[model samples]
Target: MPPNPTSYDTASEMAGGPGTLEGMKRLWTPAWIARHVAMVVLVVGFLCLGWWQVTRAASGNTLSFGYAIEWPVFAGFVVFVWWREVRHTLRGTRTERPTPAPSATAGSEPAAATAGVRRPVRVSRVPVPGDGVQDGDLAEYNRYLSWLNANPDAKPGDYPG
Candidate 1:
């Protein structure tokens, strides 16, 4: 006789089987697709930049060789970030749950010191690394802006700029 099919078996299979791919499959939302497309464009842009730099080197500019290498590095970094973002998005829901607090030597984990800082109770945007986000005191910002204004060459000075 054939074995009986129970809800337990079905749930167990779903929890451990090919159904895990569901998150990966459903990952192709518009935003996800857009990010992939953008990543591709970024890679192509990097290749073009590298090629342009190489050609500049061929035409006798010594600085272009460094750029040729740098552009490809930029492409690799973009691909790395894109892959990380995808993986993070897929796993985020599952792994975002808070873990149990540690005791005693938990101080070794280095918690943020809030002693002098007035952090907003409401959740706000936290900047990602390498995103170049700067937000804080208005007066300091104004001072920075004035410094930039005084420096003539401060604006948009990156390689792509």
Candidate 2:
């Protein structure tokens, strides 16, 4: 028998409302279905055992031994099935494809300015120390010096203008 919808629905909704096919796929995967099936089987088996024992008592038949034997066998079967499902899930399926990076727009400023010194400084040519003077490095350093030189309301000796 299928699970009661109201319980499953409330459970699913609490777990994020069945947003996508991938989410749905995870919910109803073979491993998941097998686990639920095993659980239902165990519940039914136990109920049947209880009913049988009660009915035997009513009929003045001592079914204690019969129930004790049958319940364990059914329970073992259910446990074996559940173990298989757990192993299958642990082995795992449904690999996620790598998500692509978003396209950059011309209007969007790169985070270089706000990001400050931690950001990668793209020098036209990286300077090799003791390789005389690199023009690109000299140019960038001069631009920085000029900016430092001009700001009037700056602190006095902090960066000598």
Candidate 3:
């Protein structure tokens, strides 16, 4: 049964007009098509990897048995994320990331709730002091060098503690 035109439906009102298949055609754009093709290829590649791992496990290579189950799971996760993105894009809403709802830490904001643009992550590889090349051993090494500098008669193997 058709509803009366005066019915209050806030979502449809905000949608601006009847959501139709016209915008859904954007799903077939070249970039999206390529993404779909890549998704298919990734699934095939994962299946091949999983099969190879399974064959290895059958031949007494126990390590590959775990990997045999891993590849297909990765493929499934990729498809899930892709499906969500397609649905989100076709909704005709602003693609900017929605602000996270206020939490118990109410005043704090999420770091990168931008216009759907993600910031690149920076990875630092500096060695901390105490672990091998970090602090304590480095000081000990420096002390050994200084001790060698002072004790000219010491043999090269005679490192100071």
Q: What's the lDDT for all of these models?
A: 0.73, 0.63, 0.77
The reply for model 3, stretches above 4 Å from the true place, is 1-19, 93-161
Tell how far residue 156 is off in model 3, in angstroms.
33
> Mind giving the per-residue lDDT tens digits that candidate 2 earns over 1-161?
99787665442333323443434565477878876786877868876886777677677777665774677677767777776865455434434456655666899855443334685677768745785755888777786677767876666455643
Candidate 2 deviant stretches above 4 angstroms: 1-27, 54-59, 93-161
Give candidate 2's whole-model lDDT.
0.63
Better of 1 and 3 by lDDT: 3
Order of models, best TM-score first: 1, 3, 2
Superposed by TM-score, candidate 2 places the C-alpha of residue 116 at a distance from the truth, in angstroms, of 60
lDDT of 3 by residue, 26-143 (tens): 7779999999999999989998999999999999999999999999899888889888888777665523456675454667756544569988899888955564555678678888
Local lDDT at 85 for model 3: 84
Per-model TM against the reference: 0.48, 0.31, 0.46
**Which candidate do you rate higher for TM-score, 2 or 3?**
3
Clashes of each: 0, 0, 3
**Total clashes in model 3, counting residue pairs 3 or more apart in sequence or in different chains:** 3
Best by TM-score: 1
